[model samples]
Target: MEESKPVSYYIPNPDDDPTNERITRITNKIKIEDLIERSKRIKGCKVFQLEGRFVNLFNEAYQAYILGMDYTTVSLCALASERLCYDLIESSKITFDGRIISNIEKESFYRIPFSELVFFSKSIGLLPDKVAGKMMKLNNMRNVYIHPSFKRDRSDPEKLQIKPESDSVTALNNLIDIISGFGK
Candidate 1:
C-alpha cells in the first residue's frame, strides 16, 4: 500500500492562519530596514541625486515615526512625495502647449495646486491611477494636519485629537514607493 500523505501538508486557509500577524509584522520590519538602507545609499548615487530630497524627507519621516511623531512624519512625507512627483513630471521631456518643458514652464507647473498637479500627471500617463489616487489621499491627510479648520469636525471640544499610528507608517511607505520610482 502507498504511504498516506501527512495531514500537515495541507495549506491552511488564509483567514484562519494564526501566524499571519507575526509574518506580517516581520515583513514590515524588513521593509522598513530596507527603506532605511536605501535612503542612505540614495544620498551617494548619481541616479538618485536629483531626487535626494525626497529620500531625505522619507528618512526624516522614518525617524519621526520611530520617535512616535507619526502625524508629523506622515504630513512631511506627503509633501515630499508631491514635490518628487512634480519634479519627475517636469523633467520627463513631456511637451506642453506644443513646446518642450522649459525652466519657466516647469516653474509654472509647480505653481499649480497639488490636486491639479495630480490630475495633470494622471492625464499625461506620468502617474498611474493608483499612485495618483494615493497621492491625493496623502494630500488630503496633509491638508487635514496643516489646516486648522479641518479639526473642527471633532464631536468633543476638550479631547486631544490623535490619528492612528499605523496610518502614518502606511502613508509614508506608500509615498516612499511612489518617490522611489521617479528616478527610473
Candidate 2:
C-alpha cells in the first residue's frame, strides 16, 4: 500500500495541515528577519516629500537593492525619480509680475514625458542640478537595461549592455543622492 502524503504536497492547507503550518511559520519568521535587515540597509532613506506613492516606490526600490534584484532596483529607482519630478512640477509655479506661469493641469499631467519632467524641474529650480543630471543618467541606464539594441549591433553580440550589479549600485546611489537632496 502506498503511504498517504500530506495534503500540502498537492494543495497547501496551512490552516489545517501541520506541515503547511510549519512552513507558513518558518516563511513568516524568515520574512520578519529579512524585513529587519532590509530596513537597516535602508535606514538612511526617507519618504520623498511625504507622498505616499513616492514613499512606496522608494522603499520598494531599496528593498530590491537589498534583495540583490539589481535590475529591478534600477528600474524602480528610475520610476521613483520620475514620480518625484512630476510631484515637484505639479506643486511648483513660476510667477512673473503677478501672472501665474507654468500652469500644469492635473488631467494633462501624464502627457508630459519623463525627460521633459526632469528638465522642467531643473529649469524652474524645483529640482537640484545634480539630482536632475543623475536622474537623467539613471533614466538612460534604465532604458538601456530595458532595450539592449547595442548588443544586437555588436560584432560578437555576446556582451551585455550594462554591468548589472555595478550599474545597479550606481543607479541606487544616484537615486539616493537625489532623494537626500529633495526628500523630506
Candidate 3:
C-alpha cells in the first residue's frame, strides 16, 4: 500500500502579533490609497505585458503567412501563455494534473504548467467547458511563445495576424472582485 501524504496546515504565529514592531517593520507603512494604487499598477503592468506578447504573436503569424511559412504554432502558443498568466493571476493559484495548488515556489509562479492549471480551473468552478473554450484559444497561443523554435523567429519581419475579441479582460476583472471579498 502507498503511504498517505500528511495534510498541510497554516497556523498563525502566537508571537507574531500585528502590534509587534518586527511585523510592523515588514508590513506596508503607506496609506490605503497608495496600496490600492500600487496593486492597480502591478495589475496594469501584467496586462500590458500580456498585450505586448499577443501583439508579437499576431505580428509573427502575419509575417509567416506572408512568407508562406508555418508560424501558426508559435503565434498560437504566445497567445496561450499570455492567457494562462492572466488566469493564474486571477485565480491566485496554480493547477496541475487535476490538483489545485496554492503554494508553488516563489520563482516559478509565472511558469505554471497548463495541465495543472486547467484541472484546477475546472475543479474550482472558475472555468467550465464553455468558458474553457475561450481559455484554450489563449493557452494554445502561450505554448507557441514558450517553445524555443518560435522564439527564434520572433524578430523576423513576418507578422502574425491575431485580434483580441474576447471578454477575457472582463473576466479577469472579476478576480479583483473575488479577492476583495476576502476582506469582507
lDDT of 1 by residue, 38-81 (tens): 34422222234664356677667767666556778778878777
> Model 2 — TM-score against the truth?
0.66
lDDT of each: 0.68, 0.71, 0.43
Using lDDT as the measure, the top candidate is: 2
**Candidate 3 lDDT by residue in tens digits, 121-175:** 5576655554454455445544444443443245663443222221223222332
Judge candidate 1 at residue 115 and give its lDDT. Answer: 93
Give each model a TM-score: 0.62, 0.66, 0.29
Measured with C-alpha atoms, the lDDT of residue 4 in candidate 3 is: 42
Minimal lDDT window, size 10, model 2: 1-10
Question: Which lDDT tens digits does candidate 2 get at residues 124-168?
Answer: 788878888989988888887787463423555654456767776
lDDT, model 3, position 171: 28
Which candidate do you rate higher for TM-score, 2 or 3? 2
In terms of lDDT, the poorest run of 10 residues in model 3 is 41-50
